[model samples]
Target: MIGLLATVPALIAGIRALRDRVLEVAASGATVVAGVGLLAVVLLVIVPSFEILPKSARDAERYEQQQRLDELDDIDAGFGPGSAEEAGQEMQEYVDDALQLLEVAPRTMRTTTWSKSGTTAAGNTCRAFHERIRLGDQVDRSSSAERLRTAWKAESDHTSFFERNGVLELSVHPAAATISWIRADNQLIVESDCIPYAAP
Candidate 1:
């Protein structure tokens, strides 16, 4: 989506040049071919950059998850296993910081102030949510973590996280302006309306 949006100006320029007949037919054809090729290359380059964005999100999520794991380890180290109270306390702390760790709403998030619809929805609320995970760890269906894990796994066109039973449910499209359920929360929380584009 970002790739396509970024390419709009170049696409427009190419079209304008062709319309103006700035070059002979043969030259224009070559330019068209080159433009198409450049588009392909740009898409390829942009695809990898998208990976960087999500991977960074994943990394932060992992780190936060690990921090919780470490806290659990420390609690268990002192109190032995089955320390639900301490674990829950640690989990609460984990929940508090999970969203930040995921960096779901990075300070650099791009927002379009101009409304395409010419009117913005009133009383809209947006917030970012994240669920944490460890490296090589597949989502465990039995745990609440599955809520976010499944969403991330099922990422595709028109999918977004909605909340149900204090957990996130992935669906074709979510109503909220922006919704992100990272592995840390395992629940749906409102995300930034500032995001006009589709989720990564």
Candidate 2:
């Protein structure tokens, strides 16, 4: 009977050990199953969903708002920390460009491209080419040198002109130097052709 009692305690210890071993095996299998489930969700669901889901512009709207700021460089042509005096250069270059736009260079003058010499030469050639413009069917050659001097300043000052139409048209500014003109039926002729006609 004492031997039987000792055997019972040993049997109880073995049964407890077996129970612990079974529980450990079950926990390990469950961990593997959960790991597989998580991996399958990532590969099948999460990865495939990338194609269906819409993405962001990464705050592109915010970037566009920043672009409109005055601190940003060259927001547009009107962007300014500019001075009123700089507009004089703008006005100057405007007429220079007009020469090309109107196809009127006749020849670059004895001086710079848009200098007094160039404008005077341009005025002379324009007068020679279109001097036949009729005022009451009367030819007006009031004086040659006076017309030349007047034409010279007209190009600079933006004043009354008829025979100097092409060069004058080019000189007249849209805003700062606006001048009214009486457009003739035949004027604004291309000055390239006028070069040969201009006096030597």
Clashes of each: 9, 0
TM-score of 2: 0.20
User: Whose lDDT is greatest here?
Assistant: 1
Count of clashes in candidate 2: 0
lDDT of 1 by residue, 89-196 (tens): 333333334334343343433222222211112212212222233212233324535435554456666555455454454433322233334344333333222211
Q: Give candidate 1 misplaced runs (Cα > 4 Å).
A: 1-10, 25-30, 49-52, 79-200
CA-lDDT, candidates in order: 0.43, 0.35
TM-score of each: 0.29, 0.20
Q: Write the per-residue lDDT of candidate 2 for residues 60-141, one digit (tens) a residue.
A: 6556445434222331244431222232344444434433333344453222211111222223321111111112212223
- For model 1 the local lDDT of residue 146 reads 47
Model 2 Cα shift for residue 6 (angstroms): 55
